[model samples]
Structure formats: structure tokens, C-alpha cells
Target chain A: MKKVMSVLLIGLLSACASDTTKPTATAEDRSAAPAAAASAAVTSAVTNPNLNPILTDPKNILSKRSVYFDYDSYVVKNEYRSLVQAHAQYLRDNAGARVMLQGNADERGSREYNLALGQKRADSVRSAMTLSGAKESQIEAVSLGEEKPRATGHDEASWAENRRTDIRYQGE
Target chain B: MLMRSHQSSRHTLTLAFLLWLTSMPLQAALDIEIFGGGATQISIAITPFATEEKLKQSITAIVAADLQRTGLFRLVDSSGPALRDPRQIVYPDWKNRGADALLIGSTVMLPDGRVEIGFHLMDVAKQVQLFDHTITVPADRLRAVAHQIADIIYERLTGDVGVFSSRIAYVMKQGNKYALQVADADGFNAQSIIEYGEPIISPAWSPDGTQIAYVSFENKKPVVYVQTLATRARKAVANFKGSNSAPAWSPDGKKLAVVLSLQGGSQIFLINADGSGLQRLSQSSGIDTEPNFSPDGQSIIFTSDRGGSPQIYRMLVAGVASGTAERLTFEGSYNVSPHHSRDGKSFTFVHRNGARFNVAVQDLATRQVQLLTDSRFDESPSPAPNDRMILYATEVKGRGILAVVSSDGKTRQELSMQAGDIREPAWGPLPRVR
Candidate 1:
């Protein structure tokens, strides 16, 4: 229990350091292998509930991976700042970590336009992560456009849910 | 997952693919609904050619359907006076029935297991034969033969080339799978060229009508592929990073203009037929996509947001030309998918007015815009090879279906499938002489 508590404290301190300064995140992430192991531990917690605590706890900010946007708008909302920050901090702590950002849009306008809009959304998320100290090499942004939708409804309720940028870790 | 496991680079309706089709067949027949027509519809009466019923297919019926769908020809009553031959037709009797023109023919099977069809088009009031021809083909080519006869009649009466023999390509999404289909101009004998567990869109037929360039998302990202209709061999024409889509073929069929995002925001790039010689055509930091070449092969029209909203723009694509792209659309803030007519005098595109997106055409000389449809959502407006009608995709009752409109916007029709969203239509060029 003491060791676990020490690890949790270290994780919290590094997440804060990374969110504040890129150089500070690089400095603390000197142990890159162990930090990557920490990400794996967090992910494994999905299947084994007690393996990892903070992100997979179902109440943590890092638990959410989707950044929803307005219709025809790729601007990341104010409500998703901390959620993006948490993921950026996690990436900053793990030097070897890689992520693929899939951007999508609602099926309302021209598909080619939606594709470009979705790409803008992905690029926007990528900018947010890079600004918060995530390495540019560790992230890739791509647009799925309106090709794949989470909900098949033709109403606004479903359209709002589909206009989003999804964050996916490497090997997912 | 199993679908990709069987995914070969080339898929012909060949023997192997035919065997595989047993497990998955072409979805179902498409249903077409036609309404409205030209200002003055031509009244014509067609009688069954002698011994036409003995043959396997109804040649006259197919020809009549082909002509009727154009909204230019109205089928009058050819039922009176037992008119099986041109000599047997009484001009006064036909004139009383309101037929300006009459068509009669005969079909005979040869000893070599082939069929010969001879047709005649006569002016009922003038009492003279305007056209006559005989065409020979194997028994299986009856439908195409009928289309050819209809073309001859259409040309004689309308003073324009007929597109009855032309084909069309579109995408059909059924359940979780999507198919790229090719069918006759009347939506018959649909053949699934490719099927996968992903979305397919923007099917552009080659100018020669032998190949199709489309965007497929089977690789988890959109990649443009050019597939030969005959050999079914395909190659990824544009696989750049980000998204590669909205492929349009040059009129000469030597190059394709595709939208790519490798450098940043979506931009237009030109590539050769075999996917080589990549050249960035449009230099814009904002979104520029959906490139279509002029019929003369000198200029290209595309959709761009460089000037605030999405509007159509034209630029010289030939050698040593102006370095500026002139804006063409000013009325609508959003106008896209510009397809040049066969004559290059006008182009068809989708226009968004308030909440509804409709099909519209703009004359190049007059800069006049003509609204062609009132559908809530209309897309992918492609003009026929004859420059007479426009085929497009529109949503009806929340289901996507194919629709057609005459160049004058006087005639309208819709083609819907039993299941699946049929959309992304590209009117095929006239059948080549091959």
C-alpha cells in the first residue's frame, strides 16, 4: 500500500509538471521505460479493475478520450481543456508513447468539406497536445470525416455526438 | 475482417469473383420514378417488330422505355389499325391518334446463332422514312441493340446525340458494407465492381468510359483508387497522409485531380493515370477540393474556402497560363461538385440555399445560375454525355437516392433502391466504339 501510494504521488507530480512546462516534463520523464509501463498499467486496468487507479477509476479527467465539437466547428470547447491537458500530461510523462487522433464530422454538408473540417479538428487536438508538452513525433492526426458514425440517427442529437475527435493510443 | 482477408488488389466479375458472388450478390433491383418532361414533348408511337416476341428480349419495349425516361418523347397509342410494317401505316389514321413520328422494325435470328434487327423511323405527317438501319449482334446484345436504335431515333428527332447506350457509376451502402456499382443508363443490370466493409464515395468515370476513379476508406483512411472496368485491376492513385479523396479525371483521361492533405489543410493535386507525376495544382492554405476539368482540357473548376465560404473557382490548367484562379460562383455561399457539360458551355453543381441543398447549373457565357431541384439535400451533380440531362444524388424521406434533371430543369426523375443508400453518381460517357 505504501509503494502504491508513492507511485500515485509521483504520477500526480509528473502530470502537473508536464502540464506546466515542456522542459520540466522532459526532465522528469528521464525514466521513459517505467513511464510507458505506467500507461500500460492504466490501460490494463480496464480489464483488471485493481491494476491501475487514477485514469481507469471512472471518475478521473484522463478517463475520457473523446473531444466533442460544435457542428461544422473544430474548435475544442472550454469544457475539454482539462481532459486534453490530462492526456497531454500523460504523453509527456511517457517518451515512447504514441497516439493516433481520428477526427470525424456530422453528415450534414458536403463530404469533402466535412473531411477537411474533420482534419481541422484532428489538427486542432494535435496543436493542443503539442502546446501542453506532448511530443510532436508521438502524435498523428487523421480524418475519418463522416465515413464512420457513432450513432446512425438522422437527427441533431446524433449529429452532435458524432462531431468529435477521438484519441486512440498506439496498438489499440 | 474476413472481407479484407479476401481483398485482392484486382477484382473482376471474372470466374473467381463470380464464384464468390454466390455468397454475396448484387443487393437488389433499383426502382425509378420519373416525373415532368420537356416543355413540348415529342409524341411518337412504336409497334412491336415482326417476330420480336419470338426472341428472348423485348427490343421495342426496351427502346420505348429508354426514350420515355428522357422526358423528351411521349409514347402515343400505336394500338390501332394493326400496324406491323411501315407500308401498312396510314398517315391520316396515325395523325388522328396524335403521333408526330412512328417506329416499326423486325427481328430475325440467323443460322449462326446470331440476331439481326432492322428498324425504320418515319415522319407520320410528312409520309416519308427519315431513318433506316440494320444492326447484327449476338443474342445477348439485344438490350444494347435496342438502345442503339433508340439513339438513332432520338438523334433524328431531337437534333442531339443520344445517351441511351451510356452507363453510370455510383456507390451503394448496404448494412455495414459498401459497393461501387455500374449499370446502364436506365439503372438495369447493375454489376458490383467492388465491395468492402467501409465507405466509398466520389466515383468518377474515365473519359473513355473504361475505368473509374473512386475514394475508398477500406484501409482505415480514405485513399483514392483507379480501377479498370474490364480487367478490374486497381491501383491506389493517391495515398498521401491525412485524407486523399474527391478524384476527378482530366478530359483527356491522362491525369486525375485529387484532393490531398499531406502538406496541411486539404488541397488539390494532379496525378497521372498510373498514379505517378504528383504535382500540386492549387496553392492555398485553406480547403480546396473537388477538382473537375473543363471539356476543352484547359481549365479546372474546383471548390475552395480560401475566400471565406465554400464556392466554385476556375483556373487555367494548360501550359503557360494565367497564375490566377477566378471565382465563378457568387450567389451561393456554398457551391460544390462542379461537373462540366459535354459542350463545355455550362457546368452542374450543388447549391445550398438556406437549409436545402439543390442541384443547379451555370452557363459559362452568361454567368446565369439555374436551380434544378428542390430536394432538401442534393449532391454530386453529373451531366450526361449528350449534354441533355443531369444525374445527381438527393435525399428523399431520409433515404439517399439517385435523381435526374434535364439541362433545362424541366424533366425530373428519381431512382431508389430496395435497401441501401444509393448515392455519389457519375454519369458515364457514351460507349466507345470498341
Candidate 2:
């Protein structure tokens, strides 16, 4: 009788240890699953293998806030694709998060024309966000035209800085 | 500043009396200062007018100032003797003084409280009388008479219609107060047409010089309003959702082409003068605004970014059924705010070249573009009624001021005020003489 009782006690202790160790192993995978899923859904292209820090670290790719364009062009360049894709993944991981994409232009054209150009640029960024996994309602795109220039200058370097799409988080 | 205030008070008193007598608002006379002139200006001499009784204003001084302000004529020293008659023979002396033309005049007060004025224009080289005219008017019409004489002499000499008798409407902002003011073409006799605390922009004169269309930002958003000069009666022509701005009058004064953002993006639309018929003139996913009607009223020119960059495009007024627009400007990546010349032969617009914005005109036939200004921020180019000069807004010492450039780009002048920033000057049509 004493041997049978000791056997039952050992069996129950092993079951408790297995249950505790299982959750500890799965916690890391749970934290990483959303970002992995988001990347997989966006494109079949190779992505950064170490995305955990990129998604959470303030000094990582997610911290980059602006996408710039060439003169009179709205096409997003290849250099900014990974940066935008990381942001898209972040937004998809956190559904409650909202962002505002403000498009700006250099003071080279008419006020109304600049306003339209800025709108197109913001829209282009919004399109990329939605295609990556973000919800349409989570983003708002607006144009500031040449009215709100980041660089108050009349040169190519200043203009290149002024013409940009800025991503802003909620309440910012 | 003190002198200007004193002059303005005196001008107000004069205008009040003139309004009571003629039942019309006499334009506030402006004082003009010439900045630059052509390389070879016509040299002319005008002797002091002989008057029986001491006149209030000097006829010779008024005429000389008017001609001098045009930058087309240089007033030679007429300090010799007052010649009331052209018969005073001193032809060799005047010719040797580098005088291409000479003018002499006289003013006589009649017994019935009227005045008789006579003037003569003569060719100094030919020693021939070019014009001799006499006019009788009320005692108060002396300034008007002088301007008419100046116009006649200017036309007879330069073969171009004078703008001395015309007026200009502009918005003057002092602190938070804005005044849509009309002054003489020389920037004198400024009288406020409307006063508001909000901003006023895009002042456009009707074809008949009796009305003005402008954008007012009173209700937190821009609204287009047309106000008659005589009655001061105003009606909001466009108060749609978003913004309504940049009003341009049709040639017949029957319609207005305006910019509205009713459907999310700025686009040009045409509204009847009475504010009834609303029709969209431009349809583009991109922004299309700043529409000016052609002289013939058969077509409209506006700035659009449909082709990825801002460019001037022309379309028929027959509506969107007339698909597509013919691009008019391709010299630069940015061209906007086009104003058609009175003759429809060319249009002036703001062009961007290497980050500098300047006024440029393109001839429709020759496809040649001429840069009219070299300023860094010149905009809102409005041609004079005679198309002899282009009035535009520019920044001087960080203050907005109006400037005029001759159509040939030879002469330039700045019309600045003692206080406040003035912008969006629309040169009105010539006043019809009764």
C-alpha cells in the first residue's frame, strides 16, 4: 500500500512539472507569432530574420517615421520598402493602433497643385500599408501641401527634405 | 506717416463732397513714385499753366507726374518761362534742351463758377503742333481734366493707351484687419470697399469696372463673394463645403470661374454672376484650379497636376463632353496662375525655374516664353486693361507689396504703402466718361 501511494504522488509531481515547462517554452513563440504571420501575408520576399527587436525596439526600423520621394514623383523607392513593411507589420500586430500619414511638398508649384500632389503621396503610402495587413480605418491620409514645409529653403537639398510622407501615431 | 495720414483725411473730405455733388464715389487719388524706366525715355518739357485766379492743383505738375510715373517719359527741366500759348517761339532752345516734345497749357475761371482749360502738345524737333484742345468743366473736375490731357499726350506720343485714368483694387492687411481697397492706378486715393478681420485674397475686377469678386475667410473657410462698387451690395457666390477661392471674371461679366474643394480636392468651377448655375469646368483626380477665361469666352485656361506635374492646360468651355485638355506650357515642371492677355495672343503665369518663382508670358503662336520678373516670390500677375503693364505681388523686405512691370520688361515700379501689407492687385477697367 505504501509503494502504491508513493507511485501516485510521483506521477502527479511529474504532470505538474510538464505543464509549467510547456507554457514557458510557448510564451516566446506566442510573442513572435503575430509579426511572423504579418510578414508571411505581406509578400513572399525574404524578410529580416531578427524581427523581434525590430518590432519592439525604439531605435529599430519601426522608429523611422518618414518616407521621401524624388522631384515630381510619388513612387516609393526600394530603400524605404523594408522600413514601410516593418511599420505595416507593427500596425497589423496591434489592431487598436492608428496612424496618420501627412504628405508634404516643396514650395515650387501652385498651392492647389501642391495640395493635390501631397494627397497622392499620402494615398500611395496608405495603399502600401493596407496591402501589407493594416485596416483601412486604422490610417488617415491628409495633405499639407506647400503650406507646412519642413525645410524653409529654396534649394534642392531643402526641397528633398520638404517633400516627404510622415507617419504619425495616435495623439501625436 | 504723419503726412500720409493728413493727406488721407483731406482726401476723405474731398471724396465726401464729391460724392454729394456727383452722386458717385470719386476714386481716392494716389501718389505715385517712379522706380525705373526704359533705356531711352522720351524727354518732354511742360511749362507752368497760366491761370487767371490761383488754381487749387497745378495742371503742369499733374500732367508731368502722370507722364513721369509711366516710366516712358522723362520730364525735362522747364524752369525757363511760363508759356501759356504755343506761339511763343523758342523752338531752337527747346530742341537743344533734348526735349522731344513740349506741352503748354492755361486755366481760366469763368464768371459762372466754371473753369476753362486748354493744352497744346508740340514736336520739338519738327516744331509742329501735334495737339491743341480746350475743355470747360466744373471747378471740381480739374484733376480729371488733367489726367485726360495726360492720357491724350501719352497716346499721341507712345501710341499706347494710357492707364492713368484707371484704378486698381487690392487687399491691405493691418494687424488683424483687412481692407479691400481701391485706389488710383498710381496708388493714390485709396478708399476701403470692405473691411474685415479675416483674410481677403484673389481680388478680381469685373469686365465693366462696376463690380469686384474676391475670396473672404470670414466663416473659418474661404468663400467667394461678388460686390458691386456703386451700391456696395454683396452676395456670396460660393459657400460650398471646404474652400472656395481664386475667383476670375468672365469677359462678359456674366460668369465667374472659381476654385472649390467641395469634392475633397481643389477643382475649378463656373458659376453664373447671380450665383445660380453651378457647373464643374475641370475633372481630374489631381488638383485643377486657378481658371481664367479666354478673351473670346470660348475657352478657359487653368493649372492642373494631372500629368504628374503642375502645368497650364486649356479646355473648351463646352463642358467635359469635350474630353481632354491641350497643354499650353511645357517649359518648366511648375507653371500656374495663368491670366490671358486682353487680345488673347498670350498669357502670363507664374513659372518656377531652379527654385525661383517669376512671372512669365508665353505667346500662343510662337510658343516663346519670356520671363517678365526676376523676383524670388512674384505671383498673381494681372495685366492692365490696356495690356501695357503687368501688375503682380512681390515681397520687399518680407512685406507684401504690389509692383508693375511693363509688358516689354523694360520698365518696373513698386507701389508700396506706408503701413500694412498689400496683395492681389486687380487692375480695373477704364472708367467710362459721361
Candidate 3:
């Protein structure tokens, strides 16, 4: 776990700048598939297992799926930058990988408004990932709103957990 | 702290529950627990109709419960003399029993099996008849006929149009399955219109009460669909590249104002009822959703964050393409889900300050804001057709349930199912003059 953290820190420091840029799916960028680089990453994923794994290891940042938000906010915070960048790099490394970003809100405000807020949260994460090197077409953003809650309590701690965008790869 | 006032009779309560289940595919019935009443309730007594015991349902029992649910009418002892002929009755007897008004009816079973109800409403002080009516309906329509009687009494006494005969649509989620349901305003005779595995929200009844438009995530994305209530036929009215939700029917019922993210931000758009002629209505930089058409159909009030924080804004229908927007709410930094009242005088919405979100109503002319509920979490403030009540969803004991707060914020009632969460309540318009 310590070794993985040190390696992720170096990767974060190098790619942090691009992670904050606005994601523009340009025509040239659409054609640039990075197929050769992906094949190499896939080979190393089997032999080395650092760049990509099945995501069961708790030490791997990719294992953390949720990006929580403050009340009535959709901005991706600075704390989750490394976590998002790790998954973005994983998506960039694996071409066939498809991801779904399900946004959610606490049980506050109108359901429709919360749904839109949830979508914005999911879109925020999608923008961060696509800008960090993930393909724009690889991610699908949707909102669960407050329908599904991680914790059903009405306290702040439960509401904090519910206001999130979950990153679920295809299948799992 | 809200008090739970159960019905006066337990038998009628069971039948109401049975009626709700008999209409649907046998699910849990939403038990209504009334809380607060009007400042001065109208004391009225509904006596058992002569020969009503011969029928399957007691007309007086159904009528009594409907009146009691409003919290505006107090049901007095009705075991007094009940007669179809009012000339033989003594009005002073009811006055001595602490009753200001009296309702008496008699049931006539026709040979062909239809039932005819002849009822009379009498004022104890005036000693004169207020309303007299004779209604004939099929045997299966006993509940409907009972509700109609309640409506007539409500309108005559309160001067406000009665909503007892109308229905309400909401989303009920049980375990993994979610169902869009429609029920009578009193929370009886519920029937599921659409059932799916995914989440459903924002049910807007068409102006005519014949159809409903809602957002369903069955396709894994929010898409607006309009379903006809009669034949159960439906079509996707808005399925754009991105999220399509927050459907509001125009007063004319020809077009729908919806929120879409087609241009990268949630903006208001107009589409025909049959899902044609899509036109963008409101153009805003920040998020703009939850559009509600005014009663006159001239403008719309929607929730927008263009002014830095979420607030309610009103814009003309013609001005949205390229015109100015008017902000309606200024009391709070967070306000959304604005719903116009039937008279178009005021709008009800969710107002949040700090962490407390409450249902609030604001006058369109005066702009005076009044928070209706002090509950922790409240949403979806849908006013009754007569503007006498506002139905919304709030959290009680960490469970999602529907609440009805009086327009003045005095009376409140909680409607909850035996299990599962009930949310997104949209009150239907008055049942067409029938």
C-alpha cells in the first residue's frame, strides 16, 4: 500500500495540470486513439499490475469509486484530483473499458432539481476524466438523484455520503 | 412535533385501504394521518343514510372521512335522526348537539342494480336547507359518488372549489421496483400506471387530467414520457442527446415546457404534447430547470442559477428565445421547483436557508414569502386546484413521505404508506365538471 501511494503521488504531480483543463472533444483528438500505447499498458497490466488491476486492492486509488460533494454543489474538489486522475489514466490505458458516472444528491430540494444537480456532478467528473486523458466517448453520465442513498439517515454524515458521483466500469 | 389524528372509525379506514388495494395490483395502501386543522373547523355531522347498510359501502362513512381529511370540517355525532324528508326533522336538535351544519342522505337501490343517493345539507342556525342533490351512479361507483357529495358540500360551505373528486399522481418505490401511481385526493383507490426497475420522478398531470408526463430513468438516462390515463398508451415526449426532464404542461395542454441539457446546460425548452416542434424557451449560462407554466399560459416560472445561486425566475414565453428574465424569490440563496397556483396569484416552492429546507409560498404581486413547513427536508410544493392546499414530500423519521399543508400554513396532514418511500406528488386539476 505504501509503495502504491508513492507511485501514485509521482503520477499525480506529473498529470495534475492537464486534469484541470476544460475537456474539448476536438476532431483531431477524436482520431487519436493511442492504440499502440494502450497495447503496451495492457501487457504491463498482466505482468506488472501497477498501472491496472481488477481494482480489488484497497491501496489502489482506482478502488475508490465515489466523489462526494458539498451541499448544493457539483464542483469536483481538490482532494479527489488524484483519485479521478488514476481512473482517467486507467481508462486511457484500456481502450475497450467503458465507464458510467452516476450522480446523486442528498434528500434535499425538489427531486427534479436534485436530479439535475446530480447530472451536473456526474458531468463535472466526466469533464475531469476526459481532460486528464480518458476518451470522451468512453464515459456515460447519468443521475440517480436522491432515489438511491448510501445511508438513509437524515443526519449530516449520511447526507454527505449520498451527495456523490459513483464511478462504475462496465459490467461490475 | 406533528400529532397523528387517525380516522374516527376503524372500519372505514380498512375499507379505504381495501379500496386503494383493489384498484391496484395489490400493494401497500398509503395510510393518511391528518395533523392540524383549520383555525375554526366547521362542525358538521353526516348521519347514516336510510337503507345504506343494504349496500356494500356506507355512503355516510365515506363522506364523513373525506370531510374529516381536509381538517376544515369536524365530524359530529351522526347517530341522530337521518331522513330523506327534511321537513319532518327538527333543526334545533342538531344545534343542541354542538353541530352547526347537518348532512343527511338516503340510498335507493333501483331494480336494475344502480344506486341513487339523495342528500341534503342543512344549517342549524338558519334552520334552512343549504344544498340538495340527487345522484344516480352504478354500483361500482359508490366511492366516486360519495366523493362527489363531499365535493358539493365543500364548495357550498367553504366557497372554494372542492378537490375531493380530483386525483393525485406520485411515485411510489417498493424495494427494487418503482411504480408511478395515481390515486384519489384523499389517498384512496390508487392504481399503478407504470412500473419499472429504475427510478421515476416529476409527475405532471396534464391540464385536462387525461394524461400524465413524467421523467423515467428506465433507459439509464432521464427521458420525459407522456402517458394517457385512459388507455395506458405512452410515448417519449423528450429524448434528446442528454438529460431530458422537468416536464410542465401548458394551460392549454397542447405544448409542454421541459428542461434539457442538449446545449450542454440544463435549459427550458418547449415541445408539443405529441413530442413535436421542439423550441428552446429559456437561454441561461447557469443551470435552468423545473419549468412551470403560469395559469394564463403567458409566462413560466423556473429554477435557475444564472444569478450565482439557485432561485426562482419568471420569463415570458416569447421572451425566452431572446429576452429578459425576472427573478421572483430573493429571500433565500437556494429556491427551486416553483409551482403556480390555480388562480395564478401565488407560487409554491422549496426554500432553503442553511441546512433547513422547507416548503414556502410567495405572493406574485407582493413578493411576501411565508415558509409553510419547518421540517428538515421538503420538496415538490404542488398546490391544490382550488389553491386551498399544497402537497409536498418531506422526511419524517428518515422516511420519505407526502404531506399536505394548508395554503395558510395552519393545517397539515401526513400521507405515508405502510412501507417504502413515497415522493414527487403532483395534484391533478379538478375533475372535469362531471
Model 2 misplacement above 4 A: A1-172, B1-41, B51-58, B108-116, B136-142, B321-323
Q: Which stretches in model 1 have alpha-carbon errors above 4 Å?
A: A1-63, B1-39, B109-113, B318-324
Per-residue accuracy of model 1 over A1-172 as CA lDDT, tens digit each = 1232223223322222111110111112333533454345445433322333454557887668899998767788999999898889988987765666778988877887788878888889988999999987777677788889998798999999889998866434
DockQ of each: 0.12, 0.04, 0.12
**Model 3, runs deviating above 4 Å:** A1-65, A70-73, A86-98, A133-138, A168-172, B1-41, B319-323, B353-355
lDDT digits (tens) for residues B39-78 of candidate 3: 4778886777878878877777667667766668766655
Model 1: what TM-score? 0.82
Record all residue pairs in model 2 with backbone atoms less than 3 Å apart, i.e. clashing: B28-B189, B29-B188, B29-B189, B30-B187, B30-B188, B30-B189
Give me the candidate number with maximum TM-score.
Answer: 1
Question: How displaced is residue A51 in candidate 3, in Å?
Answer: 17
Best-performing candidate as measured by lDDT: 3
For each candidate in turn, give its C-alpha RMSD to the true structure in angstroms.
12.8, 19.2, 10.9
Model 1 residue B200 lDDT? 89
Candidate 3 CAPRI classification by DockQ: incorrect
lDDT values, one for every candidate: 0.76, 0.72, 0.77
